[model samples]
Every structure is written in C-alpha cells, then in structure tokens.
Target: MSAFEFVFTFYSLMLGLAAANVGTGFADMWRDRRAIQVGVCAPLLAAIVLVATMNLWLRFWRSWEGVEVGPWALITLVAYALPLVFLSRAMFPGAGSTTSLEDHFFQHRRVMLAALAATPGFSLIWYAAQGTLMPDWPNAWLAIRFFAPLALMALTGRTANRLGLALILVWMLVGLFR
Candidate 1:
C-alpha cells in the first residue's frame, strides 16, 4: 500500500470509532428521551455531530504529498483524533441504568469540556506539523472560523451555548454552499 493509504488507515479507523461512539450516545439518549434537557443536550449533541462531520471533511482535505511522514507526524495525527474519541465517550453514560442524560452530562462536564477544548488545540498542532496551517485561506476567516467556537465554549451560560450552536450551524451551512 502507498504511504498515504497506510498512514490514513489508522486515522480513518479512529474517526470511524469516534463517529460510532457518538452514534451510540445518540441512541442512548433517544432510549432515555424523557431525561433529555433541550438546553444542555441540544448543544452537546450538535457539537458531537459537528466533530464527526469535521473529522470526515478533514480526512478528505488532508493530503500526503510534499510532506515527510515520520513518527512525529503519525503521532500528531493520532493525538488529534484522541480528543474526538474522548468526547464521544464523555457524551454517553456507562452501561446499565443511569439517572438521566442530563445527569450524565453534568457528571462528566469537565471531561466533555476538556475533550472539546483539546480538539482545536490538537488540530492546530496536527495541521502545523503537516505544514498546512495557512495554505490558501485568508487569516481573518481562519481565525474566526477556528477560534470562535473555542471562545464560545469558554462561556458557561445557556445563552452562550445556544449562540455557539447557532454560529456553528450557520458556519456549516455556509461551508456547504461554498
């Protein structure tokens, strides 16, 4: 197999696992739909979907040309995928009965936040390591597109979460059109 295919297989596997985990979490939530809090569950669910979608897009955008694939690059890429896995796990309750999805979310809030926070940070490192940080994008668009969600995540209010979700949805819609 080619180097790109070889290296990408591992990355793709992790991404698939992440998506499956998120899907399982959604199923669990649906199973316990009575316990879902729209205020909390909606944003968290949206973020999970966003992460999975973005990871898929990232795989498409990533290329193996003109760059050396070494231990460090592989390590960085794996590290980048780690946060998604963690976030997926965080979103779901353990096996067996649980109080509620909201309760699970509150109990694992820090883990969820840490995992979410790590995604952009690790993504920055992964892109930088691959020498694709700025490619052909305008700096302002990159900053707003990448950093805005992180900034929104810093807020701990319901309004902030709703706004953040709206921003992400709008941004994603624009991307689809483009």
Candidate 2:
C-alpha cells in the first residue's frame, strides 16, 4: 500500500474506535434510563459527532494525488487521533455501572473537558503540518468551533455550560451544511 493509505488506515481505525466508544457511552446512558445533564451530554455528544465527521472529512484527503506522505505526517495524524479516543472513553465512566451517567459525567467533567479542549489544537497542528486546511476556508472557524467550549469551561458557570452546549449544536449544524 502507498504511504498515505498505510498511514490513513491506522488513522481511520483510531477514529472508528473513538466513534464506537462514544456510541457505547450513549447506549449505556440510554439503556440506564437515568436523569442526564443536558449541559454535559449535549456537548459531549456533539464532540462525538464532530470526531466522526472529521473521519469522514479525512476521506477527501485520500484522493489528493501529489501530496507527499512522510513519517512525520503519520506521526501527526496519530497525535490527532489519540485525544479523540481518550475523549470518547472519558465520556462514560465504565461498563455495567450502577451509577447514573450524569453523575459519572459530573465526576469526570474536568478530565473530559481537558481532552476535548486539546483535540482542536492537535487537529489544527496536524492539518497545518499536512497542509490539509484548505485556504478557501478561513482558519478562524477552527478557533471559533473548538475553543469556544474551553472558554465556556473556564468561565465555570451554569450559563456558560448552557452556552457551550448551544455553541456545540450550532457548530454541528454548520458542519452538516458544509
């Protein structure tokens, strides 16, 4: 296989696993039938969708004929994928838990948000390193979409969390239209 294919195969696999992990978390939450904090679940679910969407977006790069794929490019891709997996796993505390998903989410909120906050920086670096962030799209969207959550988290209020959730939903909608 070509270097690009070889590297992307692993990248895609990581993203797939990330999506599955998030799906499992959601399934657990649904099956458990407990009160869920919309503030937490909304953005967490949005992050899941965003990660999966990113995997789909990567498909477009597979056809970029002349871009050179090197060892560092592979490394960068892996770096971008790792936090996604961590964030997915963080979303749900564990399997077969009696504790409410909402409680687990509150318990792990800081770690989960830290992982969520790191993903965009890693993604931007990977894309820039790989020359994949198209000039046609203003890079500001990356900052607006990714950092907004971190800013809200830092603000540390119910209003901020609600605003974060709204931002995430809006971001998802914008992604859908793009």
Best by the TM-score measure: 2
lDDT of 1 by residue, 80-103 (tens): 677777777766667665456656
Q: What are the per-residue Cα lDDT tens digits for candidate 2 across 65-98?
A: 7435787766766666777788777766566666
In model 2, the clashing pairs are none
What are the RMSDs of all candidates, in order?
A: 3.5, 3.6
Identify the runs in model 1 with alpha carbons over 4 angstroms from their true place.
Answer: 35-61, 67-69, 126-142, 172-178
**RMSD in angstroms between candidate 1 and the native structure over all alpha carbons:** 3.5
Superposed Cα deviation of residue 25, candidate 2 (Å): 1.4
TM-score for each predicted model, relative to the true structure: 0.72, 0.75
Q: Which stretches of candidate 2 lie over 4 Å from their true place?
A: 34-56, 59-63, 66-69, 126-136
